[model samples]
Target: MSLKREVLYQKWRPKLFSDVMGQDHITVTLKNSLLRNRYAHAYLFTGPRGVGKTSTARILAKALNLEIDEHGEPKIDSKISEEIDKGKFLDLIEIDAASNRRIDDIRSLLDNVQFMPSSGKYKVYIIDEVHMLTNEAFNALLKTLEEPPPQVIMILATTEYQKLPETIVSRCQRFDFRNVSNSEVVKRLKVIAEHEKIQCKEEILWFIAENSSGSLRDACNLLEQLSIAFDEITISKARELFGIIDENISLKIYKMIIENNISELIETLQDLRLRGIDFKSLSNSLIDVLRLGIFTVNGATEIQGYSSDFIKNTSLVFSGSDSRKLITILEKFIEMISIRTEHFDPLLDSAIIHLTYMFENKRIIKEELNQTQEKEIKSPLNIDTQNQNKNIETSENNIKESKINDTQSHEKGLEVNQISKPKLDSNEKQDWEKVLFDLRRAKFGKMVLGALLRNVEIPKKLDEKLVLKFKSKSLHDHFKVEWQLELAREAVKKAVTKVYGNGIKLVLEEPDEEQKNNTKANLLESDIVKSALAMGAKVEEEKEG
Candidate 1:
């Protein structure tokens, strides 16, 4: 006998309103609407991916048009349900705006929507990624979507609700499909684990649930991926597969940052990069652990996955304010991870413990601001008009004076990022390391160009130009590449001006004329090239004639 095989996600996909997880409020409302026989003409199901926007639409569609049994309950027609689930129902139309986002597509859809249902009571139209539609397409869709025939029901689904026009959103009953909560995800995963007979640790299930970031679809997908690797999944197997950092390592990093141990923090981050852990994942895990620490410190027990000893130890690492600050910084770091794929050195350069005391600075500034506002509020009427005018004038003068001072400093080559067309002073020179670090620390390139620079070591300075000799020709050739060369030059100049108080020229070795012509000579030996040459081929020269 052949064993049945199916994807875990597809096999356990919800077929009924009650079967949907982490969306009781939505499902309950949907069930109530069906129970009352109150049908909405259109619905805008908006939320993050995998929380069942499309799935719920199918369930709602089935409920709306399902054949009824004697008891008045919607009869379970497996074939029809399967068709709807597969988006193949004759009356159920599924349009992906990502592919068919043109006005013509919307017009075609509008033309077809006028017709009545062939099989059931209602014809359901599901438009996925509706936000991707062009403005003209949206205009064409507006009339149809707003006032479709009573028998026709439209379900518009989108991950980005904000991308949808307010005009469209206003016309339909909007239902937000929130990301599945971690607990709900965990509960569902546990059920699947038991069904699959995969005896995994509770922590493994929680880890999978947590990592999915509230997308139940993502959770299901992750569960399926794990299933491929393990008959009985363990936490270690999951961690290694996911490249999750150890608890001890996480604690150490957090502790080091909180303690303002910049060097240690940088070293730790470098080691993490060496191990090839995804920075995005590592950052997320750090945020989770810190959040857990906060809850632990506050004596909140609702969230699980942290032992008392672990929590207690973590709780001691940071105060309430410190924890909040660290969380904010980590959140920012998490966001930055999406912009670029960071290598080892760039990761350190991008992140450091230098700003660990930011909380104190912010707190002090807040206190000063509050005090000033309080004073102004208390004694506002007491001041004479003349004094008030004088005070205003003084404040304005102070602002002007500060601006002038900044301009002067920039002129004197004191400010690094001065954009005032400032000139470099002859007295100053570039601190190559610090300037390079500063340039790399900010957003520079898509890849870690700064990391590559760090590998090149200190550059040799020749009066007007700085000559950087890479250990190998490949590294040298990277700078010579058309796109990288200019950006590299700009970065080098910026660093030179910042450290040495002026931009310096970048000098690189050029390939010899013989070497450039060698490629053409080599290509002539090939049979194809020989035939092309004999036929008077217009073989392109390396440089312009």
Candidate 2:
């Protein structure tokens, strides 16, 4: 019978330090230690999956047992190295801490520490996934790691260095490996293709590298699958075979986002789903695109795997501040996919809608802030009551001129309708009270204009115009915004028309200190406030400087 084919990952695994990809810092340190004859008794290798921690451990074992030259240079015996690689060498013991993580298994392993090497000068123990060991197992092994026999070398490898006990970690010499870069993964895959005599395109290699997420083993496995499935790998074939969400599709989706085209985005997503494209794969691709776009906008140049045109076109759609917001929003959408997929379409659409509103709200708030800053710079601490009364007509004219041809100039026309009264009569005061009381039926703002008008006297005729004097500039300013102004005008006009069939045209004004103080004192001593105070309510007086 024919033997099954060995996978590329195992068949083409790096057997030498020089063959290791994207880990020069780690490999160089270990080589230097070997050259100087200063190797540690116990070594710890930590990194993410498929970054070759276990493979490096095997290389270190080979360095320990390999024959040497007169210059102390280690020469690997391929036969013995192959035996160790296959876990057949009696002197080289390998442990899968994940399955044999119990303290009893650990104790059984440690009991063999006293025995001598069967063939080589040293016995090597390689423990994979060391963090899987239980607390008792770790405690049992700590002393041995700290004081192993001169002939025994312990090599511990794990993906999660943080989960390993500090006591165990401190006892061993630790080497940290980084995730392999895309370019390095591509380079190694290219070597595999040439060695295996496979026909693969450059874009196909990039697709494999991207989908691998920086794991060399995963990239090799992907390549192996593709090589077995197809005689030659093409871009379209790779997309179809692996359900790869092509960059063009991602770019089109980004264009929809930029244009706020929700309908097109949904349709495209649905079509892609119908074509058997994986939503998770598409999400991953989109995350990469968004990250690249952010990098492009901030003038960051570290990211790759996308074209410059793609980055520039996507990044140009947003400003720097907006790009950050978009990235935050996109990250949230990506997170939602992992939590739940049932409501993905509607949820993503809703998120996009909210993002558009957020952009508009930020613009409005910034404009308001600027207008407020300008107003604060010009407004002063105090105003004379008489001068304010004099300036009211002229300032009203300026405001009117700035507005459209509205009925504001019609305030002068009201003079012909009035009977030239000097003081407000009881009937007119009742009319003002009716206006304030009826505002509840026509309210438009949060602050009740009725309650605020209580701090001011009833409307009094002042020359040609009727004046509404508020106790403070703050109160007057609060009601000075266009919406508040319109609300007050409509309420008063409607109430007067309803009560007496005619209303006096009026303007709001702020009282001077003397009148303001008098009005405040009258309000405090009013029947309601006095009744509350008589019922045991305390009033705190302001201590003015």
**RMSD of candidate 1 to the true fold?**
19.5
TM-score of each model, in listed order: 0.60, 0.65
Model 2 agreement with the true structure over 307-404: per-residue lDDT tens digits: 56756666665443456466776778678667665766556545544554435534544466677678778994575889877665554453211121
CA lDDT of each prediction against the hidden true structure: 0.66, 0.70
lDDT of 2 at 150: 87
Residue by residue across 65-99, what tens digits does model 1's lDDT show?
Answer: 87644333355666777777676789888889999
Q: Which stretches of candidate 2 lie over 4 Å from their true place?
A: 68-73, 272-277, 299-303, 312-321, 330-346, 358-545
Question: Which candidate number has the best lDDT?
Answer: 2
The reply for model 1, stretches above 4 Å from the true place, is 1-5, 67-73, 77-79, 258-264, 299-302, 319-350, 355-545
